[model samples]
Target: MYTPRTPRIVAARRLQRRKDRDQSGRFLAEGPQAVREALAAGVVLELFGTGSALDRYPELVAQAPEVSPVTDDALNALAETVHPQGLVAVCEQVDVPIGKALVKQPRLVAVVAEIRDPGNAGTVLRTADAAGADAVIFAGDAVDPYNGKCVRASAGSLFHVDVVRSPLTIIDLLQDSGLQVLATSGAGEDDVDSLLDGGLLDRPTAWLFGSEAHGLPEAMLAAADRRVRVPIYGAAESLNLAAAAAVCLYASARAQR
Candidate 1:
């Protein structure tokens, strides 16, 4: 195998400009697992650059058509982490379609609003893929679904699931589509397993999750046909966003089967 040449410059400076990602429609996805996931999901890789670990990933690289070599400093600039992985990829946006098809699907769906954290947003989408949810929608000022950390956190589910950035309210979308909406309120009034493994999966469902601090927007929950909570046996006040999503989506899938 031929050795790769490194890029000329190593950019230590963090380019915090707003339009950089928007302009390129690309973001930094770090780590081999993240890279493998993206490749498996069929994301259009604009560029793939690696560091010292390239030799360990001979098989993964063999699968890749070709890749550019990058300096650690250049990767550090774009990385969400301090100690960067040896590999980072620039990927094009995966635009998921919306409208009636979203509402018509038989699988349970997840919706997020004001989830500013890219990692959490990615987790929800990743959950959607695992639990076979029909789709995911980001309502209001949620994080960009295409953010690199989001994509990486998704573990490449960004390739399999339909993720929509919607201007319309989840309630309006639900109402128009004749879906039963469930909002996770953490109130512990009802159980999710009984709901899903029995009847909720029979009907088209849309699940809503909101900001970590604010929870679901009042209007969105008010429109919900049901507000459910994950039962707690422990003293923890809440669940991590990704964990909560995995539980919810899988419950719906188990119910349907």
Candidate 2:
């Protein structure tokens, strides 16, 4: 049983702090969903601090009763969120084995490339879980999968998803698998909604979304089996990465149903 430390942890108040995330390689897991998922993932809970409001998750706390309880004052700085969820855990990042990363035959996959934002990456993961997408592969230049903010943004879905990271060329893998490598383009041959419903995604498909500022690299755009765009009718310049992921993944969900 781990004994509780009284003095507070400094600089780690905000979950987004690089030191905090890097040190734990797990960051802070807060809220019911996040905490539940982390527990399911077999994350090593260094410490779990909670408030009376969250007595509802006793079963969850049972996973680690030695977990410390903290007042909002201590929890606030630890999480750095405006409203502390009353439950937070310092956990070790769950690592994925390379062999178990990919399924033998995945009909649908979410390929996240060059995605820098942790929140966006986390949300995409959540979307993948909800859509029952086969897997999530992080190509080169993606954000840390275990970023606290991302974990929080995912609302706990990361625990259920199969996330993989590989060095092979992403398009090469898809093409070799005979899967349609569709990329989300700001301006493309087909609109996103039309293609998703029209059958472009009917086969084994890999959906890739790029960085926000610059859509996708030219070479990658060229390699796409096809390109699809999400239409914007409102005054918004562009949809945020997480929102766009939800839209794209939901399209696959609709098709599957």
Candidate 3:
């Protein structure tokens, strides 16, 4: 079993940091599901697991290229969660430039801006995937999608959709792609249902979501082709970012279908 100080183990631990991940263009995918998806994507450079984990997923271990057996202490040290499923995979980062993703002329996209929470970030990715969005862009101070918390929250959906991290305003990209960029806000003048009923959802579109603590920025809202609010039927004060995204994306999905 590999010790905690093993070169491979040390390198994988370093990937837990954003600086190292950025420099190396690699991140750690923890748990069986994320590792399984990473393996299927053929992006896994190395795999690590305990004896028990290997025994459970023998087929996956057989397919993985660089497998390393680790002691329990090493595995625990590698995992970010209190209860890791005893598996982690080192994977190449899988993000493309926003321009490159836009050039494909996607039918639907989700743009998350200035979101700080990794759990929320990952949930949005999962929702976007479920709605069959062609891409998801994390822009403007958003948390890294490759963060351990985010990866776990996304389950395996992070592997299903194109993810882009960009500093330039996504409004410009959406406009260039001929997509209707819809900014979500509580005080929006347009209602989501009305827009959906008016054939707006049939068009190629991009949904803009902001941080939970703060809604969309004024400039972003202004830049959008239209600003729309999801209707609140009950006494709830406001929808969180993930809930709002699910409603908006599913509406677009249903309408397009």
Give the per-residue lDDT digits (tens) of candidate 2, residues 1-257: 11223443443344457666667555677776777777777784544455674586778778863477666566665664677766777766664643465435676788888788877788888888888887787777777776767777777777776777754366876777766788888887887778766776566777888878777777778898888778888889888776787787778767766
Better lDDT candidate (1, 2): 2
Q: Please write out the lDDT profile of model 1 over residues 1-257, one tens digit for every residue.
A: 11222332221121223356656655556778877866675563533454565666766676665566655555555566667677666555665656744645546788988899988998888888888887788888888877666777788777777777786465876756767888888773567877865676567778888877888888877888888887667999888777887787788777767
After superposition on all CA atoms, what RMSD does each candidate show versus the true structure? 3.9, 3.5, 0.9
**Stretches of model 1 off by over 4 angstroms after superposition:** 1-18, 63-66, 100-106, 188-190
At residue 198, give the lDDT of candidate 3.
88
Lowest-scoring 10 consecutive residues by lDDT in candidate 2? 1-10
The clash number for model 1 is 0
Best candidate according to lDDT: 3
Which regions of candidate 3 deviate over 4 angstroms?
none
Q: Poorest 10 consecutive residues of model 3 by lDDT? A: 167-176
Number of the top-ranking candidate, with TM-score as the measure: 3
What TM-score does prediction 3 earn?
0.98
Ranking by lDDT: 3, 2, 1
CA-lDDT, candidates in order: 0.70, 0.71, 0.91
